[model samples]
Target chain A: GAGVSQTPSNKVTEKGKYVELRCDPISGHTALYWYRQSLGQGPEFLIYFQGTGAADDSGLPNDRFFAVRPEGSVSTLKIQRTERGDSAVYLCASSLWGTSTGELFFGEGSRLTVL
Target chain B: GESVGLHLPTLSVQEGDNSIINCAYSNSASDYFIWYKQESGKGPQFIIDIRSNMDKRQGQRVTVLLNKTVKHLSLQIAATQPGDSAVYFCAENGAESKLTFGKGITLSVRP
Candidate 1:
């Protein structure tokens, strides 16, 4: 793809339900990132993947939030027992090499609304 | 805990006028900085980036100024157009390859 792509542009789920958001990064890009953005705020780091392994997951917030990139190209973010506080936009980004320069390309993002 | 934050919450500029948005960061160890623009229902797009080694960088109609002494960053947009209306964010790359972002500022370009 020309740019990073994300699925389920908008998802409204009841509290305690499980939801998954997917991201397809640009072809040949090896670094992937997941971020969460609440209304009126900037994107917050969630997880970062260098290839199929998670290089960092310190920003996951809790055990309910998890992400994986099994093939290194596409990634998925899963939330278990979603809470109303989880309502926000989940963003995905990719970089050619690493985030050394902070120049990662971002996707449209998936809006999750936990009702 | 180091963090980045905007000086203001909103900036309104007239079409054809110049616009400047300011940001402040607390971390002195940050080596890289980037400016991102986000429109409604879309993700953030990179505008310009400046390394700690450089004080300034310029793009098509945008310029980023970095002042490490005070940990301040600013984005300047020339001849702002209606299409330029969007939210702008300043991000800093810190430890662990993580980019910490500040709360965005809304840029409103009046016609």
Candidate 2:
């Protein structure tokens, strides 16, 4: 894709149901990240992947949140047993690797609405 | 608990006037700071970024100032326009590598 692509621009799922958000990063971007933003708060980091390895997953709120970037290209964010509190905008970003200062390119974001 | 925050959650500016948004970050090891502008129904767009080594950086009509003494960051918009009305977020790239954003400041430009 020309830029980072996120699937399901909006998702409305019932509480307790599972949901998966997918991200296709820019070509050759070795670092991918997931973030969650509530109604009035800043986006909080969920996970980050360096190539196919998750270098950091410390920001995952609980065990229900897990993300994987297999093959080092596309990544998926899985939410198990979603709760009403899990509803928020899920943002996906990608950047070149090796440097921490590389600017991140963001996708349109998946707006998850857990009813 | 380290946190980044905006001094004001919202600010209103007159058209063609200059606007200033302030932010405070608690991390001393932060190497990079960035400002992002997000409009309704859109993703965040990068405005400008500044590294801790440099106290100031400028972009198109925007300037970012970093003050290490107080761990503060400020975004100054020259001649604010209507299109500049959006939520601005300040993110700090701490030793953690990824960016930790501050609670956003909404910029409202009144004509």
Candidate 3:
């Protein structure tokens, strides 16, 4: 894709349900990142992937949240036992490089609502 | 823990006026800073960025100023327009490779 792409733009699931959000980064981008944005707040870092490996996962809120980048291009953010507090806009970003100074390109994001 | 923060939650400016948004970061080691603009229902878009080595940077109609001594950063937009109404966020790169973001400020442009 020319830009980052996210799937399941909006999802409403019951508590305890499992959900998976997908992200397709721009072609040739080696750095992928996931973030969560709550109402009236900026996007919070969730995880970062350098190539096929996760370089950072400390920002993930809890064990219920997990992400994987199997091919180093497409990534999936999985949530187990969803809670109402998990509701937020999940954003995916990709950068040409994994360097600290690289600018990130973002997607529209997937809004998850746990009822 | 150190983090990036904004001074105001919201700011209103008349169309065609200049707008300034301020941010403060606590980490003294942070070397990079960026500003983002997010519209309703859309993801954040990069506006401008500045490095610790430089105090100022300019884009098409935007400017980013960094004051490392005071840990302050600001984004200045010239000729504010209705299309510029959005939430603005500031982010800084600390010891880690990830960028830490501030809560963000809503910019309302009045015609």
Model 1, residue pairs in steric clash: none
Of the true interface contacts, each candidate retains a share of 0.87, 0.62, 0.78
Model 2: per-residue Cα lDDT over B1-111, one tens digit each: 888999998999999999999999998988889999999877788899998899999999999999999899999999999999999999988856679999899999999
Task: Specify the poorest-scoring 10-residue window by lDDT in model 1 chain B.
Answer: B91-100
Task: Write down the worst ten-residue block by lDDT for model 3 chain A.
Answer: A95-104
For model 2, what is the alpha-carbon lDDT of residue B110?
100
Model 1 Cα interface RMS deviation (Å): 0.8
lDDT of 1: 0.94
Q: What lDDT is reached at residue A23 by model 2?
A: 97
Candidate 2 vs. true structure, TM-score = 0.97
Which rank order by lDDT, best down to worst?
1, 3, 2
| Cα lDDT of model 1 by residue, A1-115, tens digit | 7899999999999999999999999999999999999999999999999999999999999999999999989999999999999999999999988779448999999999999
State the lDDT of candidate 3 residue by residue for B1-111, as single tens digits.
998999999999999999999999999999999999999999899998888999999998899999988999999999999999999999998866698899999999999
What TM-scores result for chain A when each predicted structure is judged separately against the true chain A?
0.97, 0.96, 0.97
| Model 1 lDDT per residue over B1-111, tens place | 889999999999999999999999999999999999999999999999999999999999999999999999999999999999999999999775789999999999989
The best candidate by DockQ is: 1
For DockQ, candidate 2 versus 3, the one ahead is: 3
lDDT for model 3, please: 0.94
